[model samples]
Target: MEVRRRDPCQSVQNFSSSSAPYHTIFVFLIPLLVGVIEINNVQNRSKSLIETHLMSMCLFLLAILIYAFAYFAAMKSELQVFKAIEMISGSLCSVSLVSIILPRPYGHFSFIIWAFVLLLVAYKESFHMKIWQFWNRFGGNNQQLLPTKCVVGCPAYP
Candidate 1:
């Protein structure tokens, strides 16, 4: 029989309920709240049950994928995950902005989108300090994550 050795750099470890970070509550609450709101909006605004169900399923899948990615990244303690999360959050913000700015009759979806986008932004920004520290500690200061020469003097979001 072979005994497995644990990696010293492993970031995730099993912990008792009491030992877990309280901040993880946001992980559960944000998804649950957004799901309920998305379902309610789809039900109220969609023209038919089929459309509502379809949209809800799509939203559910997207939300699940996003949450899964975030959870895994957090567990694995990967700093690169933030870039993907930021891209998705920015896209969601753009969608919400469009929904708010456009003169359309998408009242229900508008609020739902806005809420989800805000939640995502808040969640990501909550770790801004940690992310910055990680980058600096890992020798990422001199390396550029994105090309910025296209726009002179302007800071790139990526």
Candidate 2:
């Protein structure tokens, strides 16, 4: 009698591919549910927008990371990349939740900055680009583009 041994990697690949659809559905449904709950509970409509935006951004990033991870797993390559994506997604989700809970940080400016940093980190990791390269591309390498004076002048500035 011959016993066949199933390869663990093969099982994981199968599971990841097979579960992709469910993951997609779960990702899409989460924002809708959270938005409804937040809308009802939040007294200030303006503040709710910031919380919803951060949550949606985190979910969007997670969806992209999961899609990329599943694609690579199916191809049987980039296991290390999968791990990196997993870590970033976990951290991004945690930060987003924390920002929501502490909603008054610098009048939500800090949350926006935090979300931007998470995005920048994810972009840097995925594409192996330096932070300066990204800023130069989008920010045009202008020293005065952000204008520290305005940030410092804001009432919320500490």
Q: Give TM-scores for every candidate, taking all chains together and pairing residue i with residue i.
A: 0.36, 0.33
Q: Note the clash tally of each candidate.
A: 0, 0
lDDT tens string, model 2, 1-158?
Answer: 99986554454444443323333444555465457547655776666544566654556567556655654564465455554454445444444444454545542564577668767766666543453356446643443433334343465333
What residue runs in model 2 are displaced by over 4 Å at the alpha carbon? 1-9, 12-78, 106-158
Worst 10-residue lDDT window for candidate 1 reads: 14-23
- Pairs clashing within candidate 2: none
lDDT of 2 at 34: 55
List CA RMSD, all candidates: 15.1, 20.0
